[model samples]
Target chain A: MLMRCIRAEMRKLRGAGIWWVFALLPVISAAYGTFNFMQNREILTNGWYSLFTQHTLFYALFFFSPMVGVYAAYLWRMEHMGGGMNMLMTMPVYPFCFFAAKGAAVLAVTLLTQGWVFALYMLCGRTLCGLTGWPPLQIALYMLRGLLGALPVVALQLLLSMVIRSFAVPVLIALVGGVVGMALVAQDAGIWWPYALVLLGMNANRAQDQLSGGLGVYVLVCLGFTALLCLLAQALLTRRDVRA
Target chain B: MRAAMLAERIKAARRHDLLLAALTGLLTALCAAVRPEEDWQRAVGYSALTVNLSLMNAVVMPLAMAALASRLWDMETRGSGCRLLFTLQSWESLFGAKALRGLVQNVVICLAEGAVFLLAGRMWGYTQALEIPRVLWLMLCTFVVNAMRFFALLALSVRSGTQVLPLAVGLACSLLSVFTAFMPERLTLLTPWAYDVPLSAMRMHYDRETRITAYEPLAFPAGLLAAAVVCGVLGYVLARRAVRDQEV
Candidate 1:
């Protein structure tokens, strides 16, 4: 049933033309990142590491989470409109399956975007930066870790989009969350904040692995937040009256 | 028109549009409060604060305007309220009411931000005298930029019948605005979203070795400001037409 729900969600998204959002934002970020890196070449001499930070700085800090918000909002948009919520509640599928399906769909898109961002990073590092030996193994690890870190954000945004009928409000919240997360990370409190996790995981604007000493805590926090959001969503789905 | 505007206000009140204003104020305060104390002691501290505040505005305003403009129209789009509402009122009156309400909200938000900047400066115990005129200038520039964005997004929402496009474009514009700070000045002027920083009354320079940051006053960019006004008027005209010609 959950598989069926996931497929339904994917089907709804087919030919929605949202892929351009996931594609265009990173290209813009990469363009800016590479330009900034080149302009400050003398100071940013860490080669691929410096280049990686440049690429992910704004992408992680500003663009990525909001893109996730857009996807989550789009997924729930149809459901929130004109008798759709009532129809959804009447369906035999468990609310958990309904919510999980949306999360999974958003997760799949996020995973693809993360890989694309990394691909752009590597391409820029090699062709633009011009000195790359297979790109460091740690960079791939950072990309993977960034993907892992995005789970809680995806969950939280999914939950928000579910509750907020306004397509833009949830996305605005994500942007503000990203800004607040940047502040929290600056105060060395990234692991505790779900929005900060992705920034920490990406090691944005820094050459060193930000979560090196606290990787376990980071992973645990991500899982904890995701689980909490899931429970909240389920309770809201099963207990609350449909707004429609 | 007055009746229509009053009705728009009542609708906005019920919709809790003021919350977005509060959010904007709170964000400005947060941005102000987060600066380190040491930075406030420098000779150019107040000017530096102004520059930073402009950058923060650049980041925050696009999304806020997008959300506000989208929300104002989304209610009508949902359940085909636009058709029902059009039956009762002229499209020009309806469009004017929304635009006027949005303009008023934008003013309130800018005033709140300027107030917060003043309050934060006082709390931080800065000795530099607060320049009321300069702050007002910054606020006015911010209002212009936000009005432009709000109208653009409002037009898009009305035409597209979907809030997603305006919001997505808003997110993209926010990202580009931040990056615009890094681009050449001539190029930055071309992107309306990037106007907050360029229109700022002060600019900051940091000396890497000495680690001293200085702020210099800049003549207000009248040409860009005029361009923004032109774009905003164009957006208003387009949005009005969209409402007038809307099939229902």
Candidate 2:
């Protein structure tokens, strides 16, 4: 049933033109990152590590969470329309399956975006920055970790979009959350903030590994937050009366 | 016109649009609060606060305008693409009402932001006196830029019948504006979102070695202010046309 719901989501997303948003944002980030990286070569002497920070810093800090908000909002938009939520509630599928299906859809898009960001990083590093060697293995691990970190954000945004009928508000909240996350990371308390998880996982704006020896705790936190958000969403769906 | 404006106000009240405006102001205050307190004690502390406030405005205002504009139009778009609303009122009145209401909300946000800066300076026990005129100038600059962004997003929301496009553009503009602080002045003038930093009454300089930062006053960029006004008028005209010619 979950697979069926997921398939239905995929069908709804067909030709939604949301890909342009995902495709365009990274390009802008890469352009700004590359330009900044080239202009400051003397100070940015850490080669690929410096380049990684340039590419991911603003993207991770401002763009990624809200992009997820857009995706989640778009997914739930149809349901919020006339009589759609009532129809969804009456369907045979459990509310958990319905909400999980949305999460799965957003997760797939996030995975694609992470890959695209990595591709841009490598492309900019080798071609634009004129770096000679392949990106370090740690960069790949960062990308994977970024994907892991994004799971909680995706779940949280889906929950917000589900509850908030207005599409733009959730996106605004996501942007604010990202800014707050940056502040938390700066204060050395990022590990406890759900919004800060992706920034910490990506190791944005820093040459050194931010998680380092605490990878276990980071993973546990990400998983724990993801589960908690998903359960909260399921509970909301099960308990609330259908407004539509 | 009065009735239309009243209707817009009623719609905004229902949607809790004032709350969003207040939230935008609070977010700016929060961003201002993140600066180190030591910097606030410098001789040019108020200047530093002004610079920081403008940069924070660049980050927060564009998206807030987008959200506000999109929410204003979302009701119409959701209910048969304004077909019903058009039957009752002229497009010009509808556009004027929304534009005025949104501009009023933008004014509220700007005033609240200026209040935040003053309150922060007082709270931080700044050495320098707060410049009332400069704060008002910054507020005016922010309002013009945000009004321009609001019109552009309003047109996009009206045309697309979806909030996604406007929100995406807002997010992208906000991201770009953050980096614009590092770009050259000429380059910064080209993007509307980047105007907050360039039009600010103060400029900041940081010494990498000593980690000391200083703020200095800038000559007012009257030409840039003129350009922003022109762009805002153009956006408003374009948005008006979009509403008038929108196919029901």
Candidate 3:
């Protein structure tokens, strides 16, 4: 039943528009990261994952996560509007599977997007700096770090989608947050806010002399919160009015 | 009856777009005011331009062309307000009117803010008299780029129900627009802003090695501004079709 539910979620996610949304991740990441990489090509040589983690991680948390969050919310909104929730509720499956399937799908789509972006980014790097030796593990770790931070944003979007019927609101809210949040967070570089994970990863990857051991504590806290958020999302999805 | 129908749309738009515009204008100016003139490049210039691109294009303008277009076509989810403008308006005229109004209002507000910014800059003495023309030209080009933004955003918004994705896409495109600055000065012969201002005329090369050329005109804002008409018109046409088909 759970597998079926997840499959059904994937079916809706296959919508052409959603694919375009997914496609946006790499294009945005690559385009902007390229600009940054060119602007300061020195720090980028640490490796694929390190450079991306450093340059793109900060963006993933604040702007990228929020933007992606809206699309995540929009994914469920399809079900909400199509009356899929009520239809699924009648099935033999536990309703928790519904939210889980949807959330997992969003995560998968995000990974696919970020993954493609990573590939394109590496290509850009090679073109510019004659770089080689694909460090899959490091890049994977960097992506994992970004996904860990993305949990709260995804959870928040899901929670908001349940209450806010309008598909328009999430993007606006995310924009407001990204614009304002970056301004505030740019001040304290070491804070454990979900947006800073990429910066931490990037800094850690860069392994520059400027960083210290305090970053490990920040990572532990972020991962801890990410787990808590997943639990919170599952609980909310189980209890909330799916029909609304 | 046709006149009445048009009147109703104008009213409906005023209700949705006008209040939002005024509020957004105040918010934009307030946000811009918080930073000192020295930080203007980061705060107002790059950030505002970016958010306007990668973020909410309509939120900044209030009566964004997309909202106007979407509302006109009824692809947007229904509003709580029960008005005949929702039912009676044709998509073509509706989008045309909305796009036109949005352009005018956005430009006016932009000019007002520009004036205030200049006034503030003068009072603070951040620039000299010689720099005023260059600044004015930059502002003029930015205004045109904003026009393109309105066009591009409106068209995309009508096709995509979620306005943010398109806005972000536009933002990404704006970033891509920077690549034009890298073109050799002689290659920039196509547009008025680029032609009149001259790519070399506006500090084409940034000596970032020294970090002193941060104020240099990294790209021809005029070329971007000139693209506004083409992008805007194309956006309008696309928006009109989308609205007609109820595409979003």
lDDT of each: 0.84, 0.85, 0.51
Over all chains combined, what TM-score does candidate 3 have? 0.66
Model 1 segments more than 4 A misplaced: A242-244, B9-14, B32-34, B39-43
TM-score values for chain B across all models: 0.93, 0.94, 0.55
Q: In candidate 3, which residue pairs clash?
A: A54-A202, B53-B171, B54-B171
**Residues B158-243, candidate 1, lDDT per residue (tens digit)?**
99888877887887788888889768888888898778888986877789999877778988778888998998888888888888
Clashing pairs in 1: none
Better of 1 and 3 by DockQ: 1
DockQ of each candidate, alpha-carbon based: 0.63, 0.61, 0.17
Model 2 per-residue lDDT tens digits across residues B11-104: 6665677777877776775666534456455567667767877887788778888888898898787868588888888888999999988988
Alpha-carbon shift of residue A13 in model 2 (angstroms)? 1.9
Per-residue error at A206 for model 1, in Å? 1.7
Give per-residue CA lDDT, model 3, range A121-233, as digits (tens): 67776786455866566556655656655665565666566555445445444544444444444455435555445445433324442225655765677768667766776
Docking class of 2: medium
In candidate 3 the C-alpha lDDT for residue A128 amounts to: 62
